[model samples]
Target chain A: MSGLTPREWLGLEATHNPHRWYLPVIPRLSVREIFLFGGAGLAAATTALEETTERPVVWATAQYLDFAKVGETMDLDVHVSVSGRYTTQARVIGRVGDREIITVNAALGRRELDLTETWPTPPDVRSPDACRPRGYDYDQDSLGKHLDQRFAPTTGKKLGGPTGHGPGRLCVWTKPPDGVGNSAATLAVFGDFVPMGISNVASQPVGSNSLDNTLRIIDVRPSEWYLLDIEAGGIANGFGHGQLRIWDDQGNLQAIASQSVVVRDRLKR
Target chain B: MSGLTPREWLGLEATHNPHRWYLPVIPRLSVREIFLFGGAGLAAATTALEETTERPVVWATAQYLDFAKVGETMDLDVHVSVSGRYTTQARVIGRVGDREIITVNAALGRRELDLTETWPTPPDVRSPDACRPRGYDYDQDSLGKHLDQRFAPTTGKKLGGPTGHGPGRLCVWTKPPDGVGNSAATLAVFGDFVPMGISNVASQPVGSNSLDNTLRIIDVRPSEWYLLDIEAGGIANGFGHGQLRIWDDQGNLQAIASQSVVVRDRLKR
Candidate 1:
């Protein structure tokens, strides 16, 4: 919050209380921005606690309760529940006045070990420049406009149709706004885009409101673009469940994320 | 806690306080039993709160902080963080005296909606009776003896060897001990077996200790065998991450579960 980098321009301002932070929901960062802040803001507060303990976060899960709208300011308060030699467990509560918006549980630690391998190999797809640039004409207010994305070769152009032709999966090359650098906070922001896969495989126009966004930080490497491989596992009884793997340009798996959302049929609405 | 069934024998004894429960780690319930208790105990406490609220739990996540050993009794305290018309957010802390073993955050609701579908089809495999019974002989003290399992045809007989020959996955028919019924609490207990796949595919003897177990409950049906389709996403930087889809005998998807674990090379140890 001090020397503002483009990434820090998430509008997260530190408060007098060291454990607390505030974020104002700006227009560009509003709609899907909730997912970004729901993850990034919570990660920011958790990261702040890391400064004192000097530990890196291994995992963080944000349970989203309510949505934050444009012009609304959200408050994030982090409390370290337990601190051990190698790990720290913390919880962050995000609120808008009396209403709670989100709650994040985080585990932080940095212990080096020899075991290392990524089982899922990145698909050999065309470079980002070769694919069509993804647009937000479907939802004019989509936060997709804030970031740049190129649909992967396997992806279809339609929003809602039959995706059963293949596994319920979608891949996209997502890049944060210019000047934003790759970091845990940025990865958390980018990992929440899996719900788009629900609509991608839907039979009609449907929107999903995520109940939780769980990000398991692996290793964030500096790169211009992040590859998000999303698999929508199931959609049943008004809810949709999915998992996403965030990979760096070098094909290093950075983080694993999963979520459950309340799916609403926009066309029926 | 009263008139207990085999499933109820999770050894979760209720206290005078309505919001509190205790778990005694017995022989059959030791080792991985702690994870079962960590999830089931929290679900028990959350379900108790449901008697008054009449809402079923939709999702629950347990973060493993410390180990609850044999001969030790753990306490589960449930705190309802927020209660809404269709949803309730709560947290349960499991502790042994001053030491916290696990923390669970749950979302409960009873909203009925028409949208229903499971994208992932149940694998076409041999029935439970046709497959060979799976057991654990490596660890004499293994809690696996308490339940019954049948290995899927696609799974290899070797526990720790290369598994890249097939899809990075494993399927098993898991059944709780006698008298245990198919309940959400039981499903919670059974959803934590993804680690078996690690050893199933590992080239060396490796043991995985889960850091977190997250279960997203869908629909529970009456069935003798629960199909666990586990996919080992990756093992990198000393950690292994995976997801499991729980299905009933009728091929109805019940829950989607995921976990992150710290892998230890037992042969080296």
Candidate 2:
């Protein structure tokens, strides 16, 4: 039997319908698939709620449940829990018909003007084209080609010695061949960097995919370049934590996203 | 009179001691300020861990416990809540000499090769410059000049109805003023996109500023034009929620962000 492609499974519901799509979980897709799936759910939720309530997507946070495979179809669902003129809330889940794959809670809101507190700016660098590309052993694979990256000048070219591999703060321009804009595409982009931090600081290039991913998108221009300044600390063994600053050229200061990633020991670039 | 910056307090034995920063409290900065100060504490922690453990920041999630302010000096006190080879966890606090301003728990990990997953790609659109520069209602008196923005072809151009706002995904090219990378410049660039999600979508051109900011730099980059793709939703009580995707020009996804902004009301352009 012909199995459903990822896009086919995703298209099951209209943008406004609050439902989950469950197709055979592709083992290859893993939680990484869930990351984008969750993003798709978020996209539907944002679009539906905004049009229905005449609002827009403000912020959302989600967790991945488990690895999914391609042959088995999973259940995808979304619920509009709270709907207000200025904001809306949703709870979403994905399951393998019975076994759950992921759960998400997203909030949507109307635009408002207020004075709150936010992050400051980072340092400067040249345009993406003018910058040097730090080649990695993995650059030869899908991870490298699907990117449009430009690194800052202050940073070292490749990964290196202890002192935690490198300093806090890294900026690179990235996107799939599609450029930037699509929500699911963003997920694909972020998941790619899950290893850059480790690769830069480690003496040699290392590779690790996200076990589970979490993201928080701050307000920013969809058409402008985004700067990701990252910092990490405390890696005694294989696992550790990192923080990131997602910014745009317009000075809109976006949200902060943080999550836990699993390190696969055998992989190398 | 003597003045102290967040960095200065970080230098003092009482405040700098990773074991003893959040002891005192100053009320003017408010509980929110305390939470932000708590952010400062982690900023310091992230800096130190980078030097000692030398691991790439793979994952980090921090919640604001309280808030702090500009004029007063705050402290950073840290404790290792969990330690492992793959990850190390730390809990740190920010305080005003005697009172606690904020607290946080963060995770760090090692780096390696990334696994699989694919997400949706955006329907290609024209470059951002095709759009015009739009004027926003946000009071960017401080950030206006600091931010170098050129909106989408229709940025400030006239459009009808609020019906077309889309999480369908949009794009922009962004850059900050020169010399904003290291020192305090890094924070400034990250801080600028705080309200970009809203600004990117609003029919009337509204903007949000950064307030109560949190940043996690997973990768470090100098300065470059990072692509920012954002989606806004969950509008209620004049407040909105949105997410941001940061990419390099080559279409590599680098960072993801989200924020909560108050969308006071919609207006016709």
Candidate 3:
């Protein structure tokens, strides 16, 4: 363990100003060392929001406006719109120089109530130890390489393989590197896998550029592995929509995420 | 039919500045004449963004910061963050005087692609004609009065009634008064039903103050009635989460909405 928070692992730097934060786009934060990963950008914004408000994130939605390529620095400006006794509503706009990269609106804080319940049951799947390590077509130093992922038994064929047309759903167990604890920022990184689930649904070498990602936190608990139960709702008009239910290894529901992505066909190398 | 567009029906007026719009929170636009309906506020923002960007909204998410009560006027400021060749990323910040009420981030425009499909099948329920009108415990002059809703066959009990502990799901056929049409803004207005669905899930006299609502448009087609398939995901730490699937009578998926609300216990008179 690096004894670093998820924010530190992302290399998010704090300026003297409480409302301003900076993130340098390193190769580990990029996709294929080309551009910043969408989830990492959101995680950066989320980290800033939580820090500025001094409250845990309850929910956050990020709209991807542009790309911040590797080697660029993103400046995040946090704006607190409303700060009530129980909750704080804020937003963060990230830009590289003059180009806007992402906008995130979030609600933070909590309320005391006696009611607590969850309705959705976690999918029945083998433990992460019983599953095989997930393989990636592109072997590059990027965000995906830092995490350990295993496909559950339900995921019949590996990605980029042939499959019968079925309900667009995939289950995978993921464990981040040692220092990345069960923080909301860490879950934001895992929530960006909806585009990958879309590829399985389409049965092709197709992925997406996310237009927006919305994450709703239920309960974040520490566990060795988290199951990403992803289901693609549909694809139409060159856009695909899907959602993910994150479950800890102890069968605790942690968070829920939904996203809309711009569908793009990938050329097989 | 009043022949007014959904924007006009909401009383959204264009200001001298191209990036500014105004909405008067009249009783018809409010909930129980208390505050602006959460969905109506989002609809107003969607209208402003659509007019300013001249692009159909692909998806929009709104975070409710404060309440704009009846008799207040909301000023919406539209900001275009990035305008790409085929898509535009923008946001609308609505304020009542000096208090910020809502912040909406959206992506708009369309792309030309032949790929189109919807995987989730609509629930098997009786047609709207065969269903009974949904009864509201509180009769007031508000937005709910303007919408004609019918409980689907699966919805066995009405609000504030006893229900067997089962999966937290409800379906209702809703038809807005004439002239609403099938615009993205109209869908925004209907997408705010997640809070109502939570009441059914808890099997108690409970509702919520919305924290955020996110809507993703799939295919908007005009129909007399739209089926709102709502399912409550869970409730924990004084917050509830749920999602909705809107379908036209023709079995076409119209849109998908997800929301997080601060759960509140309603008093029975």
lDDT of 2 by residue, B1-269 (tens): 11333333334344334355332333321223322333234444444443334444443333332345544666556665445655655545456656544343345554333422212132233455464443556442332334355443323333321212243234555654344332222232333353565654554455443222333333444445555555453333344444454554455444444445444433432
TM-score of each: 0.86, 0.44, 0.93
Model 1, global lDDT: 0.70
lDDT of 1 by residue, A58-116 (tens): 77777877777767888878787888766677777888897878887777775445666
lDDT of 2 at B100: 46
Sort the predicted structures by lDDT, highest score first. Answer: 3, 1, 2
C-alpha lDDT (0 to 100) for residue A190 of candidate 3 = 89
Chain B of candidate 2 vs. true chain B, TM? 0.58
Q: What is the C-alpha lDDT profile of model 3 across A112-137, one tens digit per residue?
A: 76678777778777778888887779
- Please provide, for model 2 over A12-70, each residue's C-alpha lDDT reduced to its tens digit, 9 standing for 90 to 100: 33434435333343422223333333333333333333444444445444444444454
Q: Provide DockQ values for all models, in the order shown.
A: 0.51, 0.09, 0.74
Among these predicted structures, which one has the highest DockQ? 3
Model 1 spans > 4 angstroms off: A1-7, A15-18, A32-37, A137-142, A155-167, B1-7, B15-17, B32-46, B49-52, B138-143, B155-167
* Model 1 steric clash pairs: B159-B199
Cα lDDT tens digits, model 1, B1-269, are 12344326576777788677787777666664443334444445445545434576677778887777877888878787778766777778888898888877777775545666666777655788888887575554445676788876643343422322244577888876666766667777777776877766655567887777888877877778888888777766666777888988888989988887777878677
Model 2 stretches astray by more than 4 angstroms: A1-17, A21-55, A70-74, A114-118, A132-144, A155-166, A179-192, A203-206, A209-212, A236-238, A249-255, A264-269, B1-269
Isolated chain B TM-score per model:
0.87, 0.58, 0.93
